[model samples]
Target chain A: MDKNYNIDEIENFLNQEMSAEDLSSFKERLAQEDGLQEEVDFHATIVEGIKQSAELDFRALVQDTRKAMLQEENTAAKVVDLNQNSKSRVRSLGSSRIVAIAASLALLLVAAWWVFLSPMSPERAFASNFTTPKDVLSAEVASRLEETGFANNQAALQQLQEAMLTYQNDNFEQAQQQLDAFQAQYPNNEFAAQAAYYEALSAINTSDYETAQVKLLDLVDTPNFALQSDAKWYLALNSLHIGNIELAKTLLDSLQSDSKHGTAAQGLLRRLR
Target chain B: METSTIVEQLRTGNQQAIRSLYQISFPECASFIKKNNGTNNDAEDCFQEALVVLYRKVSDSNFQLTSNIKTFLYGITRNLWLNELRKRSKSGLKLVMDEQSDREYILTADDQVEQKQEEEVKHKLIAQAIQRMQGNCKDVLINFYFKKMSLREIAAKMGFTEQYAKKRRYKCMESLKQKVRTEYATLGL
Candidate 1:
């Protein structure tokens, strides 16, 4: 068995590029040789693996495209809903006079905005950009429980689920407490990073900027944290909430290249500048 | 788009074609799934799996579409959701079967679905191995293999000579094989 066998030979055999005589000879050698079959199988696996990788990438593209289409449909539906609500309200009013008054009020509000609004402040920026992170952990935990039949980490997953449910229900302070307890009890759990992340988000939602900032900093520094980019973005927003404009700017600069947060960060940076 | 054109575009991984497929097929598929006690997420998953199955089928040079693309997709999604429902609850399967009996087409077999799942697991292992490779090696192999780039194109893209690109691809492939070997060994496969 040659250590440096040409990979192309295996590829040619697998692809049926060899002549009939050459393939016959190769098959005979494969039968006679001890390791040649293994080598060929290994090469075939690599080839198939590469093709599968490409197919997986294509599947991802399809999924992403579907998501984008669904998002567009949702946005369009929202616009239609708003239009219908406005139309019903207008019909209920049933008065051209009220409509005129509303139009005048809108112009007056615009004039007031032009006359009295100051430059964007850090607090205003934070308020404009910050949204409470959605409770993703609940669904993840539920799916894991379903897959594993609640056999492993049942207690931990249930606790995480309870905390996520609290967060989802807008019980931020209680969620934070529950998350802290989960972290303390299961510091080395596979989902500990996720718990830490939601804990920080809970603090931020409750206007406890200092606590949130500390937790976000820890998350940003944690290796292999799946939500590191998200932590960085929220940490930047936390800095803005605390009037740490310089820190916010620095963090936002770092996030300027992040795919999910880059455009938002760039927009926020421009406003800050 | 025509059915044949859509299939061709999907075979080539066209995003617009995928979006069109979603717009054309998803609403009816979602309605069917929802009627059968499946959520929007389940509908999405089944639909995506159907698309993958369609892509795989059409990738074969001998594949011929016996039905319209939408019909084909709906059949696959229906079968996939039924398979999922059966897994989730056998009691629900009777009700689903009652509803599904009216459908004229069921494109995929249970064994084929299982095969796809098995292939998915294998592909994921390979993808993980590729991810674990060193950066340059990973990039070269991904470019040459997944991206379907020729050695000359990869060389120009990576700003290396063609000869270097060829050698680099071979070495990276060997590295990937070693990584996959370790993965198989770890799983005792």
Candidate 2:
């Protein structure tokens, strides 16, 4: 076995960037190099996580785009297109934009604009797409993201994005480590809330509902949060997932009566029933 | 319902045909902007660009399809939509909060030079495998498949008797078949 089967080599293999000759050689060496394959699988998980996230992101983007096109036409015809956008049963705003909206919303709550959006704005209708497009989460990551200010810091943001891909690929330990690192590095950074939120989501994806709930519960009141509403939404959804109808109803109640979420939330609420 | 057919109908001011084509391909092509990591609004904007591509392709006689009409339209749409997505992803990420998923599909076959490059990759892969043969075997195969040369003419050109040419031709075809199978298998096709 070629003992030189290093981390870089394994990462390259995971990426499918290896030359054909290198692939042939790597295959030849695989029979006896047990550790190498293990390392390769670890990296592969991270790579696949990124891809899965990308796919969800793309699908979400497409759904939102379809709605957006329709909305654009509506925007051309109507004074308050929000009402019409609310009518959409499915749609998603881009993640960063959603986070900004959430943050701005928090800012508005404390400061000047309490409600920047028109009740009829299509944004309300499309909000469900954001969570659907988001990866399954552990409550820990979910709650971490609930702290609105977490999504703003660049370092925290990079670590969280990297962790998201890692978690999706089932590199739980690495993901946890990354999350821990992110929390340690920028606990109050803008991306921190989202990062923490995803940390919880990563746990949820693994079916650790109790842990996920704990993580979410931890972040429920964390101030300066970007995804508090989303965390609440996920908590409510998680209750349904765990077969706790009463708890689910309670969590759902905490969210603005779907009408506040606009038509999309109302539609999702209808579906939940 | 196709841009090509619609273009034909459009030339005669057939409003229904034009609308049918636009209605079918426009939103899909437009929506791809989001599917490949763009905002919903960006996808809407992508429709006009996709229409422009259809307009150009429909006018070009060489743009005949060997595939389904929608697939062709989608191919073009996916290409054009992705191009805009890339441009926006780089510049608009700041204003945009969360990035959309699926960024690995940079440029697909519908995008101008990228389309040509993909075809060239296909040609090169198959052609290189064919190059594995030598001398008469290679020459006979190329003459038959690539040049579309007649057996009698090839025999004369290669200074071979017709009988000898025929025998060589039989062997050459077997070799070609094997090569094609290996090449295609490598591609998992």
Candidate 3:
């Protein structure tokens, strides 16, 4: 083995860029060389390792996406609980009042066909279903630190925690600023997706639908974003909020089979119809 | 989406396709794993591994799907969990597979032994080495090799001359090779 063998020559050979004569000579050398073949194999393994690293990154994305979906499902479950409580409250009403109320409800049902049964306006549907997603960032970060015993990016996590606190406090404007700063400072951090997600939510809460749409669209297009499906669902609502009914329909149609949002999407579709 | 479309989209690294798969397939997979002795975390791990296997297989131009994507993924996940159980010396426990016909899609040569144990070890070492590398070096090497970016494009993207980019890539590769060698020696490989 030549100690002075050029790495470029090896790269060219591996990449199949070598001329036939050079290739033949290189092949013959490769056949006879002791350490050269091992070096080539090592380089090849490094390339494979790099590719595997990218795949692992994608796997992380998939894991985060799953976690986000689970969080959304929990939020939906809370909404369902609220509905159940309302139903139970109705059940607890006195019998005499219930009977009187039932008589009025029967009369109201006839009027409801003429009033509520008409196709709901897109803005109304958006308002009805678009609750702000519950703030789970703090819990998630705490659990992650507990599990790992060390935060890989402690400073970023701290900043995100502060921003999430602002979000939780209903200070949408400041939270959006802090999240934007977090994103700017740590564009490739693991929690950047979460930051982006919260920023979009803030925009929605502030009635900045255009900004919300832009941010949510970026999330929708981002291949590894954890809140991608949530972004899609919210983007649909944002579209409806802005009276882009067709876009809302299209987005909702895509999410019509999403486990967390599917039932809501179907109900909205019915109203839109 | 159709199974074929999912396969194609996965090959392209489309997240929508991945989301679709999770939406349509993962609940059943999770239930099956939990029905057995596995936890939800175990099910997630097996499902991710199965998706990786599927991605690798479909990347090969000669590969063909003989079953639906869901069934194929279920088969792979079941096999993975079974192997894991065997590793834990719990193979005596029977896995509650919902469908017997799913056995037809069990991964054979491709999944069980995708790489020799030695090769897998080497790859892991290399991955560790890459992770420990400096940001610029790692980026240059990955962009050139894994990303298939031309030197000119990389140079433009990184704000350097093409010649410098090529030299930087070579230096990065050398650095990575040295790191891998050190790690390999540390492992007493």
Per-residue lDDT tens digits of candidate 1, residues B1-189?
Answer: 799888788766676577668878989999999999998888888888888877766765456777788987888788778777876864433222223333453333344556658666767788777756775887677666555567898899889999999999888887787788788889886
lDDT of each: 0.76, 0.53, 0.75
After the best TM-score superposition of candidate 2, give how far the Cα of residue A60 lies from its true spot, in angstroms.
38
Reference interface contacts recovered per candidate: 0.47, 0.00, 0.42
> Which candidate's DockQ is highest?
3
Clash pairs for candidate 1 = none
lDDT string, candidate 3, B1-189, tens digits: 799998888766665567678878888888888998999899888888877766666654456777889988878787777767765774334343334454543322223343567788787677667778886887787666655778997899899999999889878877787777778778797
For all predictions in the order shown, the interface RMSD in Å is 8.5, 20.4, 5.0
Off by over 4 Å in 3: A1-28, A94-273, B12-14, B31-39, B58-66, B90-122, B128-175, B178-189
Shift of residue A263 alpha carbon in model 3, Å: 20
Please give fnat for model 3.
Answer: 0.42
Colliding pairs, model 3:
none
Off by over 4 Å in 2: A1-132, A135-158, A167-177, A184-186, A256-273, B1-189
Write model 1 residue lDDT over A34-143, tens digit each, in one string.
88898997777676677666567677777555543443344335435655686699788776887889989987885665455455788899999999878777888889
Candidates sorted on TM-score, descending: 3, 1, 2
Overall local distance difference test of candidate 1: 0.76
Give the per-residue lDDT digits (tens) of candidate 3, residues A74-122.
Answer: 4445435655686689778745776889989976874565456568888
The TM-score leader among the candidates is 3
